[model samples]
Target: MIRYIKNIFLGIYCLLQGMYISMLNMIRPKVTEKYPENRGRKEMMERFRGLLTMPHNEQNEHKCTACGICMINCPNGTIQVISRKEPDEATGKEKRVLDRHLYDLGSCTFCALCTIACPQDAIAWSPVFEHTVFTRNKLVKQLNREGSKLEVKTGKS
Candidate 1:
């Protein structure tokens, strides 16, 4: 009988403790963000990895040599480098030229291994994270722009 009375008192104490915690939290200022309303004002952190992007210069030139280093390093087959042998203008010899650079964003884990392994520093992360899509086909992106050419750097005199 005494043990039963102790258990009842203990139960009441636990209930009151839980209620006190709940009351304290309810009185505190709300930290939840109003997402839709604050869409423009929403600021992502500096190191936030959002999307893989290949930066092109004003001349529509990119640094990707189609070396396949990025494609090889990707844990998931996210990156595809398609190249074709074209006659070099300067050398008059056949050279590998990048035809297409396909990036499957749906399969990517954002591990950044491809970016790190790139010898030409071809790929980087973009801050734009709004990637909500209904179809999987929309997720596959071509990193290289149409009519974009590989940038060649010459030794400065």
Candidate 2:
């Protein structure tokens, strides 16, 4: 009977301690942000990697040389390159042409492998990460646009 009474007293003491801790937590300030209510208005990080944009020169021409290095180096095969052979008038040597460069951003890991592998210094990572699309097809971007070039040399320093 005495041991039973002692155990009940100890249990009560533990329960009171737990209640005290929970009450303290309830009064503490929370840093959790309420979502949807603050959507689109919130600021994004500076280093956040988002959407890919093709860069253009003053003439609005692309600089891609149709090199297959980027396509070969991509781990997920997210980049596709189409090349055409044309004869150089001065050198008379058959030069590879950059017909098309397609990039599927949906499967890209943003590891910057393609950017580093390009010999012509094509491809860049843009700071626009908030691209939420309804379908996966919308995420693919064609790099070899008529007036737009890949800004391989210029990016956030």
lDDT of 1 by residue, 23-129 (tens): 99999999888988989798877777899999999999999899999999999899999999999999899999999999999999999999889988888898778
Report clashes for each candidate as comma-separated counts.
0, 2
Number of clashing pairs, model 2?
A: 2
Model 1: colliding residue pairs: none
- Local distance difference test scores for all models: 0.92, 0.77
lDDT of 1: 0.92
RMSD of each: 4.2, 5.4
What local lDDT does model 1 show for residue 111?
94
**Residue-wise C-alpha lDDT for candidate 2, range 5-35, written one tens digit per residue:** 9999999999999999999999999968676
Q: Model 1, which residues run further than 4 Å from truth?
A: 1-32, 154-157
